[model samples]
Target: MTFKELIEQRAQEKNLLFVPMAHRFQEGKQVYRLGHVMLYLDRNVIFVFNGKTWVPTSLQSLLDMAG
Candidate 1:
């Protein structure tokens, strides 16, 4: 799903599992677990929580993997 769609789903769903992933990214930065989404300060990579676990991937890598 798209980012907007994902966000909407997250907002609507109250039972979605959320887990924290605090780590380094572009100096002193950490990742946040908001429902099913993981938002970061830097654009280097994205870590999405895929139900069972977290999916750590870059934008290009995700697109490449989809193809």
Candidate 2:
């Protein structure tokens, strides 16, 4: 799916909240999460909550893994 579609899908998920952050990074812009995954839109990464820190997942990597 496209970026916009991804964003829309995430928004539709009742358990997930799509929050935009002011912070900027080389990979992507900052985003906050109230769920297990923190999504960064700019870099296109998903930070899985590991009880402490967020883990990064590349969009391309996820797509490849999905296929």
**Residues 1-67 of candidate 1: C-alpha lDDT, one tens digit per residue:** 7653453355446444434365634235565555435544334446554556556666444333323
Go through the candidates in order and give the C-alpha RMSD of each one to the true structure: 8.3, 6.2
lDDT of 1 at 51: 56
lDDT of 2: 0.49
Estimate TM-scores for all models.
Answer: 0.26, 0.38
Model 2 per-residue lDDT tens digits across residues 1-67: 9774675464555434445545734244555543334445544445543457656766444333323
CA deviation > 4 Å runs, candidate 1: 1-29, 33-36, 41-43, 57-67
What lDDT does the true structure give each of the candidates?
A: 0.48, 0.49
